[model samples]
Each structure stands twice: as C-alpha cells, then as structure tokens.
Target: MSSTAEPAPAADPPSAPAPAPGRPSAPGFGQDRLWTVDEHLADILAAVHPLDPIELQLPDAQGCLLVEDVTVPAALPPFDNSSMDGYAVRTADVAGATEEFPAVLTVVGDVAAGSGSLPEVGPGTTARIMTGAPLPPGAEAVVPVEWTDGGTGGGAATAMSPAGPGDRGAGGEVRIHRPVEARAHVRARGSDVRAGDLALAAGTVLGPPQIGLLAAIGRGRVRVRPRPRVVVISTGSELVQPGEPLGAGQIYDSNSFALTAAARDAGAIAYRVGAVTDDADTLRSTIEDQLIRADLIVTTGGVSVGAYDVVKEALSSVGDEDEAGAGIDFRKLAMQPGRPQGFGSIGPEHIPLLALPGNPVSCYVSFELFVRPAIRALMGLKDIHRPVVRATLAADRTLSSPAGRRQFLRGAYDAEAGTVTPVGGAGSHLVAALAHADALIVVPEESSEVGPGTEVEVVLIG
Candidate 1:
C-alpha cells in the first residue's frame, strides 16, 4: 500500500536483448527465438506503478481506490429513530391490546423527521411518528399504522391520516390493537455503524453503495488514486475514419476507438487520437504532442517487421537520447494472433508505451493481455488480470495449433455447461469473431492439437 507516485523503472525481459543505437532491438530478429506471453506481461507490469493519490469529491471519486482507511465520524442514525410511520407509545400502554379491547391513548403533536423538539409520551399519551423521525422521549415501542386504528377509532386502520389542517386525527385518540416490546420498530443509534469504526479500509474501490456509506459517515471528499490518463493512437497508411467513404485499398480505422474504449473500461481516462498514416515523422510528432496528458501510450499497428510499420520506425529511437533504457523494444512473442509486440518508456517523463500489431483482432488481444493490466496497475487495483476458468472444449473435431507457440482462440463459453466452443478460424484479422467471443480458449505451446471434450483454460473477457 505504498503511496509513492513515481513509477518504478522498467527492467528488460530476460529473453530480450538490448537495442542497437537508433533502432529497437528485436531479439532473435532473423531467427525463431521469441518471448513468451508471460515474459512480455511481466516486463510491462514491472514498469507500471500506481498513480498518486488526490482529494476528490465523492461524486468524482467513483470507481477510484481509497488511499486511506476512512473512519465513521458519528454513529449512523446519530439518535434513535422510527422505522415506521405510526404511533410511538410506551409498551406498558399497548401491552395485551387487541381488537376485542384496545389500549386507547391521546395523540400528541406529530413527530416528523428532522424535528428539533420532541414531545414526551407519558402513561396515557402517544406521539404520531413519521418514518425516520426520532423516537420521542418516554416512548418505548412503535406500533405500525397497519397494526393500529391510526387515530380514526375505526377497526384495523390501513394508514395514518395526514397531519395538516384538513386531517382529522392529528391530535385525536389512537387505538393500539397489538402488544409491543420495548425498542421494537426503532432503529437504535449506532445500529449500522458506530463512531470511530472503520467505515472503509484502504484500497477499497468506491462504488455506489460505498459512496452512499461514505456520505452517511459525513465524508464529503476523500483521498483516492486517480485513474491513469491513456492516449490511444493507431497508425496505418490505408486507414480511413468511420462514416467516410472508403477509397480503394482503404479500410475504416477501428483500433484507436476500440483501444480507447477498452482503456476506459479498465478505469483509465482515455483519449483517442485519430489514425496517423504510415509516416514516421507524423507518428513520432503525434506521440510527442500527446505526452503532455498521457500516463500510458498505446499504439495499434506497426510493430511488425514490415517495411510500412511506421510505429516501429518512428518510436524505435524515441527517448534514446533522454536516457539509457528509455526506448521501446520491438520483439516477437510465442503466441498466436498477437506475435509482434513492443513495450518501453518514452518522453522525458518516461511514460509506458505498448506497440501492438496492425490486424484488428491482434490489436485487441494485445490490449487485453498487456495494456489492460498496465492501466489497472496504474489505478492501484489489486486484481489486475482477467478471471480464468477451466472448461471442456465443445468442438466437433480436433483443433490444431502451431508447435512451440501458444494459441488463443476466440470462443463462446457456456458457464452452465462448463464448455467453450471456438468462435471462428484462427485468423488475426477476424474482428467479427472477436466481437462475438466472450472468452479466450488457451492452447498451450506444448500441445499441438486439442481434442473435443478436453478441459482447457479459458480467460473470461466478457
């Protein structure tokens, strides 16, 4: 639970080698050597640290983690209050009262909620109390309006008459028809929370119920770790904005929008920069311009070894002059769909950056594996990884995966049946299949083929 705001320096993965000057290192660049998914994730997580704490109003602090334990200032209820709108009477007066013969008492003035003064209930008197109104002095129990005549002198009254000038039972006699016990129907002081009690512990996320509790404990503002500001950039030459007419060899840009939304879902304040064409200088300048507001930078498209990979070409040399170990490391991972990946720090502040592949499915998978956890770590969340469960593979035939490489296939999981069915073919560009998938079926690198009915690990992403 350290509150230090400064991020810890990123360490190079054991499998990754140092980059050559003016270019990022791609370990085993021309060979078969590659980093595992776990290795790449560890490096990214090692570099991220929780953001600094800041004081924010209750409404603005929703979903933020509390930086310190908050204690209750006063007892919840603060005083004895009524839980029903009925007569507040002494138990002795209402004891053994029934429909055959009821205990009659004169009603005093109404005791509405927030009333400063309270009327005393003596041996033969009762006070009409509203729900949440403080229990008046000398009143031992409350009779719900449904259990009494409600001052109408009628049998089995349903509700208490109004207390204004047109009301007939404001100061009239009320007949109690039920026996009562002391303190019944009364919310005792400190019943919910007592003074000085820990209302919320440190590292608690402030949701609606937690916010209500904080407000009940009189906490108008609290200290919490602010969400990280994430800047999402997509780079490609043939990318066009959605809603615009597509020219030949051009496709709509979706990576930046998807990643931006995904970042927000991970509890980061995300900004989506429009797609930057395949130009090294433009991409580099765009990333530089966004550094002012970015705590983490995520770029889709251009980490592959292709000639048109502008992201790799532009960011390979970034932050190299600022400090040693300050540039991105582009490398291949021993995984399907998302193989080409890059991670490192950039800018004077050394903000963390993740470079993902260009394919739609590859880009999103990389985000879930790397960027999502980074954002959660920055937000000070304890459980940063997605939930994983074991499920039987629901397929008609055996599935194949490349030897020595782990494969993650989009899937539709049925929790009730404890089975997962693959959504579509294992193509990195299958955005339609990715959209329908609620889970990722994990095929281990050691297993080249998996048969139907085999139990496999599934990562729940829905």
Candidate 2:
C-alpha cells in the first residue's frame, strides 16, 4: 500500500433519499415545511384584487369608502354670530356697569338672525341681537337679556308715550346691569373649520361621524370604492333549510347565513348562492355560475378527505389540463377549528373563492379569522382585524393540542382580571360552546401544555 494510509477511504457524499411515490417533495433546506396561519393567509390574499371606484350620493354613501379628499367648502358661521339672546354693546361703555350703578346706553337698532342689514353702534348705544344673529358693526360684547332691564322694546314705546300732541317722545333707554367680555357669547367665523383646510382625506371609510363631516363641508355626493359583492353557499346533502322539516341525519343550514352576515359586517354585499349536494357535477356548475356573477364566492363543507368529501375532488377536476387550474388551493393550516381551508381563483374571471369547513362553529371561526379581514382590507377599513390582547386564565385547566399546531379555543374574557376562561369542552364540533364564548384564546404551537397564571393572547369576539 502506498504510504499515507492509501489516502483515507474517500468520504461518501451526503445523500438525499428519493421522495416516496405519491408523496410531496421534501421542502428545501432552511425553508419552512409546514403552513402557518400567516403563510396561508398571504397566499389567499395574493389572488383576487379590489374593486374599482364609483360615485355615490350621500343618501347611498353609508359604509362606502371615500376615494377623494374633502375640504371645507367655507368657514363655519360665515360671520361672527351671537350665541346668546341679548343686547350687543360696546365693551368699553359697559366695562364698569353694575346693578347698583348701571350704565345708561341709548337703544339703537335690532338685529335678527339671517338678516343681511347691520347698523353700527355709536358710543353709549346698544343693538338688540337675537341668538345666531350676525354681530353688528361697532358691537364688541353681548349682555344677556336677563341682565338688562326694559330695553327699547322695538322703539314703539316712543310713539305710544304719554306726551301732549305735537310733542316728540323721548327715545327709550336701557340700563346695563352687568359687564361682559369682548367677543363673549360669540362664535367667530372660521372657528369650527377654516376654509381651504382638509376636513377628510382620501380612502376614508364613511360612518356617521365622517358622513356628518361631509355634510358640514357641503359635499352632497362622494366618490368611493365599490362595495365588493360576495356570494355564499353551503354544500352538503345532509343540510336542510331552516323552518323545514328535518329528516334522518339532517340539520338546518346555518353556515351560509352566518357567513353572509359576517360579509356584510365586513363592508361587503353578500347574497346566498344556495346549497348544493355532494355531487361533483352539481357543485362545479353551481360554483361556476357564482363565479360569473360575483366578485367573490365562499362555500362551506365538502373540502375534507372523508368519503363524502366532494369539494376538493371537484376542484382538482376543474384544474385538470389547465395551466392555472380553477382547482381549489387547499391549505392544511396548523390551526385548530379551521384546518381544512381552501383558497383559489375561479374560472377565467379569476374571482376569489374560499372554501371553509362545514362545521357550524368552524365556518364561523374561519370567517372571523380569515374572510372578514380580507373584506375589511378591500373596503379600506383601518381596523381590519379584531383587537387582540393578553389575558390571564380565570381558573386552572388543561388544553390538549397537537404538538405543532396553534390552537384557538373559545372562551369568555373577564375585563376585571384581564383573563380569559375556557368555555366548555375543547372540541371543534361544540356549537353550544362557540355560542357561549366571548373570545378566542390563542395557544402557541410551541407550547403543548399551559396552566393557570400563564399569559395568553386572546381575540375578543364579543
């Protein structure tokens, strides 16, 4: 053997075993292998886009997204107006007036609200002004009518005075019992909103307050983002419409109604697309029709791997032979109550479709967790998601969860202790539990066990 130990046997290169047949390829090194709630959400959002803008009148502008900036049309209170029903006087003249030693000022003229005519008050003169009346020239203050006794009651007293014929009556006078500050009881012009100032900016979601702002700015109509129209359907032959007689193993369809309400609350127009059986052909036709007619389509049920599961199979069939198949892009999210979720573009129109689980509670949770946020984003809402906060456990308890999945458990939030107590059993099929819960407490994937006094992030539902 040549010296040097025949060059230590050539080290064998690290080998990657081939992927098992019918199994997905192993994820690249350093890349994420499992779908997180956020990752799946990003993929779902990357599909359909927002709608175009439209012009709508104020009567129809409720909940519409404002597309343009609104500026103050004119200064509020076009002119300095009186805010009190009283006598307008020169502050300098009444500066020392009091009940004991009153200031006698000759009554000049009266100014009513909305009157264009205004007269100047000379020294020792006062103008009778009503609330909302423009301050007359030379008037620097308002003395409430209650503080002034017997004003020039419209100058008619001079004509009706008890004096001999051909003898002119003396002009009536008023005694100022109190002094008021200059500009008192007056709302200065442009005080509320100055002209040419921006009152509302673009992309503002118009609510009662914003609508009132528009009216104040003299805007009778506004341009806004079009309301996203959505169609919701429930699939499952075992589902029956409410108010109808139920047969064996059948329950009333609730997910559709719940989702529709959720969509509207998110600022989107929602319409029921009706229910469909487990047949692939029927579902495909129904979904196609909905895609052609709606901006988005949402359905519950038929997405799992059970024998009755037909949604995923139908979607795969539709995607066949098409470069970008209309097939549903199902995401097995590492989240409880909403694992069997699907998102994809539908048909050539590329309308967004989201398929949620059929469980009544799961569908509702998925809508709150995913669909509603998307709708809010499209409608230009600022607070798109429900606010989340840390809460303590109300009682000692155990929550079982898969070692690697983030679990969302329904519970009630106690404001006093800033804690959330789990509501009912930890099963996704618990509809009563869902109804009683006021929030969803989040348990991170890394923690398989959590005990009392441990801080947790909770989503307030109520």
TM-score of each: 0.90, 0.79
Give residue 74's error in model 2 in angstroms: 2.2
What is the clash tally of candidate 2?
Answer: 0
Candidate achieving the largest lDDT: 1
TM-score, model 1 to reference: 0.90
Q: Lowest-scoring 10 consecutive residues by lDDT in candidate 2?
A: 1-10
Q: Per-residue alpha-carbon lDDT of model 2 for 1-462, expressed as tens digits? A: 000010111222343343233212222211223456776666555544557788888877889888898888899867998998777888998987888998888867667787676768889888777788899999988887777775655423232222244322235688878888889989899988999989888878789998887887788999988778889988888878899999997777878888898899788999996678888888877877676568878889876657777887666555222634344566566777677777766666566678888877778888888888777766766677898999987756667666767788888999887989999876666778988998998888888877888888999878
Residue 156 in candidate 2, Cα distance off native in Å: 19
lDDT of 1 by residue, 414-433 (tens): 99999999998988878899
Measured by TM-score, the strongest candidate is 1
Candidate lDDT scores, in order, read 0.83, 0.74
